[model samples]
Target: MQFEDVKNARDYIVYSQGMHSYSKAITKMMDLYLSYVPYVERAHQEGKKAIFCSALYPTTWEAPLLYALDTIPYATGEIGRLSDFRVMQIAEDYYQFPIETCSMVKCLVGQWHIRKDDPGAVKRILGVSSGCEPFNMAWETMKMQGFDVHNPDVIYRAKGVDGERLENLIKFFIRQLYRTIEWVSGSREFDEEKLRLEIQRKNRLLEKMRKVLELRLKRPYYIRSLPTILILNSGVANYFARPEEFEATLDLLIEELENIPVDEEENKKVIPLLWVGTTAQEFGIYEAIDQAGGALLGFRSSPNKLFREDVPPLEAIAYYLYDNQRAGAEIYMRRFLDEELGRINARGMILYGIIGCSYNSVEREMHRNYFHQKGIPSINLEGAFQLGGPTGQVLTRVKAFTEMLS
Candidate 1:
């Protein structure tokens, strides 16, 4: 289905046929999309400077800078459309970009080539090279292709190993973020006040997000309500523009959600599946689960205590980035699951073993063992990056899992 404008496309995507009902999840997503798509389009139209991040980056610092310049910040992996995904295939098959590389990187780099001829396309990139070699290599290739690039070197140190050393590293990252901000600002003077306001607004946004997550964990009703595309579009494109409006929408959502009581019978009808693995890019995996009367609660492993509303923006962001729970380190991952499983009242766990992700693939057995010991059955489903799975087989497996839980 095609739409005449971006807003229509966004509307259709967010309020798709079966999802036309009014729900807190639908309302929140609509609010986000209305703000998100237009902001990116306006930035593209006005020739405002934009930066493409290679992965998820802290937005408290990044988004404010873009807002200051009247620009937009985008995550290459999260923002890719279906066309971009197809371009990634062409890039791998025809252009000889490594097929074994990360799907996010492959699609993002491929999207760059597709948009390279357009004068309006964002040419500057901010690449994070701390983890994922494919992402690092993709940025290197983009640099070679003449895109202006900045990559901050970050090393992962296990928490509590060296407090002072960690503080020093965070300080270094703060400096790198400041430098990147200065560069992104171009001729405009860097505005600390604007950044402070943005950070304050983002703090509210995070608070709202936390509330939303908490609600979901407590009453996991909206799991399959929104498509992975819409969910991830907001996740990736969220930082591109307005913070206050975004926060307000979130506030509205939380208020609405708080009043809604859990439907015990409805909840009993379907199995709630706690998903662990890569971003479910296939989206069909989710649809299949829905068809089989399962709710797919996507990955959640945040160290909420590490972030503070009153903390310095740089420190908060650094802490967020450094949080092992956010990065899915083994110890923290186990802890996160342990904490969240009961909250969501999940019947089972599904570990999506991505082909290229050594991290999740290797941890599958450990996760299975852990879940099994807890008397919760779990299964490991293997697929390519971003859930590149055979649709029929994936659906079959999803049905089988649901049947088992039933």
Candidate 2:
């Protein structure tokens, strides 16, 4: 498929013109997303390997490593976002993947099938065996298709472990990072200074992101909900490829938010909501919420911890990944949700996820019960991630939820 045929490129262009059209910063972000695939293709022409990663893996650890290896990083989840239902259909219909598979995995495999014959496209996948079973299975399937797949076993048992065990787990993960580096670069030896510089650059980007989040908190409507979601999405994966360009876009957004005036009358009419669970690949989810008189003030999945500068760089990455994985536990999520709800003064919650994700299926009831005990109103919305736009049922449910909140 051509670049223009990608769903995100088309949607992002419409988004650029439709919402907050006055802000050149949002347009710059749209351009960044549009430029990503071409950038990877260009790098491939330069003989750099394009390595596929997952959003589940901490970019804090992987981004620096990929930089040091002189490779380009592209997440399948990011590709899923760029694709439309046609890719998902390819996975479901042609590949014979069960309809029960996670939407992102389907997109991942489908995208690979489309580009597997292309010499310049992604041929190497770097995956972790820890999170999301479907993603692991996807990697295995791609491996069966003769793609270069390296999935390192990183233990994710972060809860109920003793201090010694936790320390051991961190050491194991650090070793796995080296193993992955060796697998990608054909050697374990990488420039420590290059990795350290990439980490420093990542840290700077994180600081700018924090500023953007703070600006959103100060004036949620000033920036709008979709842009906030996109920002968090891009920030999660270290801007997909180019950290410097992503950082520049954040700088632009921060400046625009600081200068723009909050629409008080409009803000007064909109109910502030908190989004908890996986962000839907369907961009229309945010738009639906906005049309229903709700604005997503904060995301539960937003990064709360920064890499530790006081520790050794590798150790910091290990700890960050360990802590980050631990935060996915129910214990951490409960406290985090409460803090975010209070922080943003959100009136309601939107619990959203893909239809076939086991994690979301299990967490849906738990989250609903938890919010119930806290007397917070929430609505659960489940659908295929990138299969088309938001369903009418989803839009009606959102409208009802926001009306109830109002």
Candidate 3:
């Protein structure tokens, strides 16, 4: 259930039959969990500070900032709320945060309450960039409750592929990124050298992810191992704190993958299914797919855009800015699905529509329609966060879809 070292973790992965990529993906997560116990104990004993923010924001860069400021970064979005839905309900039931608000946003409210009286609780919250209405509202509510909330002011719209508009978008994003760092540093000046080193490490992690993605593109069996899910879970576990541990797992994974020769005949028999919509699996989407016998090519989400390592920090931030400029409408996602599904040779898709997410829910019919036209079948599964859809129904649909594709 828990491994203190990576070797034992690898053995656990080998033993877990239906876990697919999850067992390995979760190893670094466990390492991070073990680190958290020490992190909390240290913060309490040594009087260290922590900053809370959304994981949606690129907080990996803050590792250097944390070291410079003598603080730790807590992505409440990933750790605080996603760990338990009851934490989110606390905001709605007790705090009277609007019941209609996004569950993730409401969870932030509950996170604040949980930490409000803690000896090492953080007072400053780095607000979100993407203005999901409920998220902004939650930020505003936290400000009212005396937390220093900093929201990056920027327009959220897709700047077309390659142009001056995209460049400008990147410039604007870099400016906001610098401002965020400056604000986080406050009286304590930022250590440029430290940040550069931290970013280099972050870029290295991204490069490893890029390699994993590259391998998955050519080898469908890699999907069964859930490399993408492993990447996502690494973030969920706040692997940024101990990136090398995460990298070590990557090393083991890469070594293991290299040894297992790609079976051409076996690959031909497996159905390639592209997962669309928000990345789930705090509730077991990856395991479900494994049980259903479908090979997931990858997810169609912001995670797909791997960060660039070669460029200068500012330019890289610009590239990141442009890459992350998600359109509010479903058109961009539709285009991505059309392009990627074909590229990956995906036979079918599973679109997980979050229950209260207005944007994703409205696009379900259009998603089904477009895939139908392309002769690619897709099932839309609905749920709140990763709690997921009805298990029997979801697995049945997944099995049926795989059977049809096969």
Candidate 4:
């Protein structure tokens, strides 16, 4: 779709959803999603390989390797907006998957079923071997279906492990990275210069995002909650393909934020809040918060940190993959959450998770109890990752939570 078409879609979404403002950045993000499949098709035509990934994997861990090998990256998480529910239903019905399966897995499987016969679609998947059973099983199903699937052995953090154990884990992860690279590129060695360039590009993007995040603290929120969530989602997933377009979009967003004037009356009504846990797929949650006079100041799913420049690019990525609290120990996750809440000066939090996501279900409660003990109010909400939007019950809880915060 063209830029104007994307802009019109964004406007319709905002108006239909009863959201507060329009965002050029969010429009560009929609454009990128629209452009993705065509880009992959063209890349395949030009003899470039394509690899599929889930949003569960850190983009930092995979983007550089893909770029160095000149491969196009397509993520199941990045496909479609409102149509995700239809795709997800196809997976559930066709595969006879249980209703309790993670929605993302069903969505991925559904996408696979729909595109399995498409010659230009990616058949090679980079899968994760650890964390989230449903996700792992989805990859296994794809492998059985004749797709070329490679699951890199990755482990979650263990308690009381440090020093030698930690070193060994990092080293093992680095080896897996190499194995994945070799599998995708058909070569044991990748161009270091290309990897370094991708690293530099990523760093530049992070710096820009940091500024946008800082700007989010401003009252009357020049950028709305949904746009910010979308941006952070892209940040965590590293855009994977054509990241430059995303970077340019950020520039426009930053400029707009810088020039926009804060509404003093709205600033007085704004109740700054934090969102913690799985990404909120429902657009209505943000609108509910807006309706309840809450401004989302920050969001955390993964640790908010940058890759190190002092170390080799690969080593830096490996370290981030190993240490980031997204998949790390409870202590690290708690520490990260506490620091982020304090940094954004959040008055309250929204702890969200997908239905049937055991991993996040446990996490949501842990975070709720932790924040409760700290005298910070938080409400936990669980819902499907469906496209039509959250149920009225979910929306009521979100609005009530934000209203209480206000």
Candidate 5:
């Protein structure tokens, strides 16, 4: 059921407020779905089993098999997009968490509370143990609400801090991800060689699809929803672990989207920024930014359409596996960054990092320094979906930056 009217409220909160507000914002948004006190019946209802995890971590990791047995295990926004306000209010009203907690947490707790009533409201809640506090806080909060929030121990088992270690970490996560999920789902683990072949296959499809993004960025005037290229990258990468299926989807999506002449450009002002927050769907910040003359160029993170062409059960060989093999979250963002910085002509960037996400925070620093040194007008404005901007403090920074560019 498509709830067109049910615009992802949690997303709006995060977008509007920032990552600090997600805990409360997400809960508040989910509040609208109930036929009870808060949420009146709406038409557009998305019934997929959703799980929220760190984009960087999720791409390079996987939830255990138990989550896959019931969940459509996946990560949420790149940043500041998924906030549960009502739930945060609930948590705040009761617990009085300090100002340091990321809004994503309160929102997750609030949502879990609701899910307890509707098992299908959300079956699985996977939290990443990225930073010190959030890892412990998230599980404790969920346990308080009685929800099975799975935390994957994706420790980078390699030595050194060089890119090789990073690469090793990526391989490590991908290798064990599915086996973990399989174990969770009461199924036998996949052979390592088979999973390795799957990663190679998906990587090839990623290579092809990235070409389309290159074309679109090089010529945005012809592409409609150019951001879809990034979104599709996430979708296709995650859905099909095999090469043939990944290619089929990439070929079709690219052929259809890339075919549209590159003669058009999105008209929103604000110099059109792709809100790169880790959990970005909380407060319609992108929409508000667009309202303030900026196009929220959507996510280059884990999208759902990048791999819809070869519908899973249709293309892969009889023995193909697609459950918790997280293949897409690997290299999409790096590619998207290279592509969008060229096309979106972003004025400045926002970090939208949760208070304690080590991987995302590190990625944000890398993104900021890269763009800042390039002199492309960027800022690593930190805020959760629930916290900042109560007084337009962030907008003040953004306003200054916008003026400097103008």
Candidate 6:
């Protein structure tokens, strides 16, 4: 069990305390807990200027904020990520936005919509845009909820950026980021040398975090989500001002990682199954796979990575400031079907086809054939993400598939 001070809203603090104390509801609430909460908190609280950024292709535009704040970073993801299973309103209270909105995205947006008691949210919310309807729709949803959303930064999908264009865009992003910082901090005199040094420092940190994740992937070194969360401070624009907070959060999580037992339970050799498609399914699907002796190694039928901003560093901050959304739904589909499918050595796929997401909604024919040619079994279930069916078909199909594999 990890030990640390909680920094989210009081409920989150209570949620954290409950988990550490081994409270009965912990199992149910565990998924909502920000595995890297303290680390994210630390990043924002550091002494330097801070701005918060959130997105899919964060590698791009976030760079400008990093340079501008001399320390700002990404916030850890919203509390209820796509995978939470236990149902209950921990974050969104339903008043912030219409319940008709996509539940998963709304789970993240709920802070502005349903759960508005916390005022700090107004201080650091920056939403990104991808070239998808839902991306803009979600932004609108936030706006409807009264969020002070600035114009979205976009990411393009025509082709992944490369070479000179990438360099120019990156430089442009830095200049735009300066404008944002000036607006927020109400001070225009930022030190140039500090910005450059911070960028170098950030590059080193991204590389280090990647390496750490690689290690965790290899040996259950499981960095405990803290360091990655700290790295996201780079994504959040305001963390620069609160370096200590980011550092503290990082320390708490890293400590958790170091203390974790090296032993990971052996997975069941169930049918080689793949989950294709996005919109986070109810929690425990992955945990179920792990506990039931099976694995959903990768996503297959899911939407692409939404709102990615993997643009090159800006030549001027304006380049960064512009919206450059990617059709993550489209990208993830091609990569999964066109690329990752054959590689995973899967026997079947569980495709959760979400409605209203045009990107993947149109790919049904392409994916079905794509997997079949690869000689993989697939099950398509059409329904709201968390609520599949009462007869437990999802679980039943999973069990049957695994039994067949065995």
TM-scores of the models, in the order given: 0.82, 0.91, 0.78, 0.88, 0.56, 0.56
- The lDDT for every candidate, in the order shown, is 0.60, 0.74, 0.59, 0.71, 0.44, 0.43
Q: Tell me, by lDDT, which candidate is best.
A: 2
- For residues 231-329, what per-residue lDDT tens digits would candidate 1 score against the true structure? 433442344355555555566667766888887777667677777765555555665677677776535422144344467655666665565365425
- Writing each residue's lDDT as its tens digit, candidate 3 over 1-406 gives 3222212222333333233444454454444543553564466457666676544332233444454455666655444323356777778888787666666566667777776667566677876557577777777878887888887766555535467776677777777777776777664346656655655665565566556655665566554534355454434224544556666876666665655667887777767788776545333445456656677775564244544657755455456545642443566677777767776788888887655777667787788888888788888886555232335666566667677777
The order of the candidates by lDDT, greatest first, is: 2, 4, 1, 3, 5, 6
Error of 3 at 369 (Å): 3.1
Preferred candidate (lDDT higher): 1 or 4: 4
Query: Which parts of model 6 are misplaced by more than 4 Å?
Result: 1-77, 80-100, 108-110, 114-123, 134-146, 160-179, 187-281, 296-356, 363-368, 378-391, 402-406
Lowest lDDT block of 10, candidate 2 = 1-10
* Clash count, candidate 1: 0
Judged by whole-model lDDT over C-alpha atoms, candidate 1 comes out at: 0.60
Q: What is the per-residue lDDT of model 6 for residues 1-406, given as tens digits with 9 covering 90 to 100?
A: 2223422233333434443443222222233233334444554445433344453222444544454555444442333333232321332354333444454554455433433455433335555555345445656665666655554444442355556766566565455555665665567666665555444444443343343333333233132122223233232222323433433444444445455555544222333456555423333233334435555543432222222224332332343233222233344445546544554556667666543344455566566777667676666644343332213566566566655665
- With a 3 Å backbone cut-off (N, CA, C), the pairs that clash in candidate 1 are none
lDDT winner between 1 and 2, please give it.
Answer: 2
Q: What's model 1's lDDT at 390?
A: 42
Tens digits of per-residue lDDT, candidate 5, 1-406, equal 1223325643333233332132232222222211111110111124434444443322332322222244333443332223446666655666566545666666655555555676345444555444357547757766676666666555523223446655555455544554445544546543444434444444454456556555544443232231232234333323312224335545654565455554444432235565565434323333334434444443444232222224321122111222222322423355566555555566656556655455567777777777677776666665555533323666566556545544
Higher TM-score: candidate 1 or 6?
Answer: 1
Q: Which stretches of candidate 1 lie over 4 Å from their true place?
A: 1-17, 24-42, 54-70, 84-86, 93-95, 186-189, 217-219, 222-233, 236-240, 301-303, 309-311, 382-390
Q: Candidate 5 — worst ten consecutive residues by lDDT sum?
A: 35-44
